[model samples]
Target: MTTNKSQDSLQQQLASLPQDVQPGRDLWQGIELAITQQPSATDKAKPKSWVYGAVAASILVPAVAVWISISSLSGPVEPGLDSAALIAQLSEQYESQKSSLLVTYQDKPALTDNWQSQLTELEDAAAAIKSALKHDPNNVALLRMLQTVYQQQIDLIERVHAPKWQQI
Candidate 1:
């Protein structure tokens, strides 16, 4: 009975609220500016295909960071499957993807200088973990760290190379 009364009261309160609130007159000018600033239709549509990859990459960044931190505190997982082959595969993928991005972006300047620096930092971190893995052989934390860094490198490259419509 109490829930039924509360539901009815909630409905009445919602019905009493105004529904016609609107933006001020200045909002249309910004909308016009945005429309005018839009790039060509072809250019606008090109990035849509890669946008899913970009979205996935964005989501991965936080998960990797959290995983890295958690794994660093915990003792390394047991040596099980062959991490060497996995690291090698990720490294090869990174190299090919990096080269492709470099070729693609050869004519264009990066959106910012910070992305390359960030990639360098991640690369350095991956190298450090790789060096440690050489000693530990199958250290799960190191394997995960190396994979995350490599994945981040590819993601950054894709992001910088892709069409940047939002910049407008």
Candidate 2:
């Protein structure tokens, strides 16, 4: 049919065309010349400002974030109450209470044999938090965590030595 003949003719024409072709001149010379040239004054000045801005933002963004986080973590301290002094006061109170509780429970045996080990673990955790506090003394969350851990230790000591009926 005429359609088949036209298709064959098109395929023959495509096959007859040269497969390999070359430019009349070397194109790399122009590209090489362009790449080797220096940028104009406007282009140079524009990029410098943009680069400086990007560099400054890179440095400042993290600094601002750190400032915000530290401020928020420390929050607003009460008038005349320093974080370190408050921590020391609370620690002293906790120690006093813990010592008195231990003295009261010295004669009594704990209900569970592993209570001492559990207390040791809590003590270790408290020590780690205290170490962190030394670095970030004003962190309220760490202060609360230390208080909670101390309370847990006290509760553990009291509960372990309490009478069976009282436990219920």
* TM of each candidate vs. truth: 0.48, 0.50
* Top lDDT hit: 2
- The regions of model 2 sitting more than 4 angstroms off are 1-75, 78-81
Give stretches of model 1 more than 4 Å off: 1-82, 163-168
> Compared with the true structure, what per-residue lDDT tens digits does model 1 show for residues 36-142?
99687879656575777886775565556545543543575445645566567557656766686678678877777798898889889988988898898666666
Q: What is the lDDT of residue 57 in candidate 1?
A: 74
Q: To one decimal, what is the Cα RMSD in angstroms of model 1 from the true structure?
A: 10.6
**Relative to the unseen true structure, what is the C-alpha lDDT of residue 101 in candidate 2, on a scale of 0 to 100?**
72
lDDT of 2 by residue, 82-103 (tens): 6676567667766777787788
Model 2 per-residue lDDT at 110: 82
Q: Which candidate is the best by TM-score?
A: 2
Clashes of 1: 0
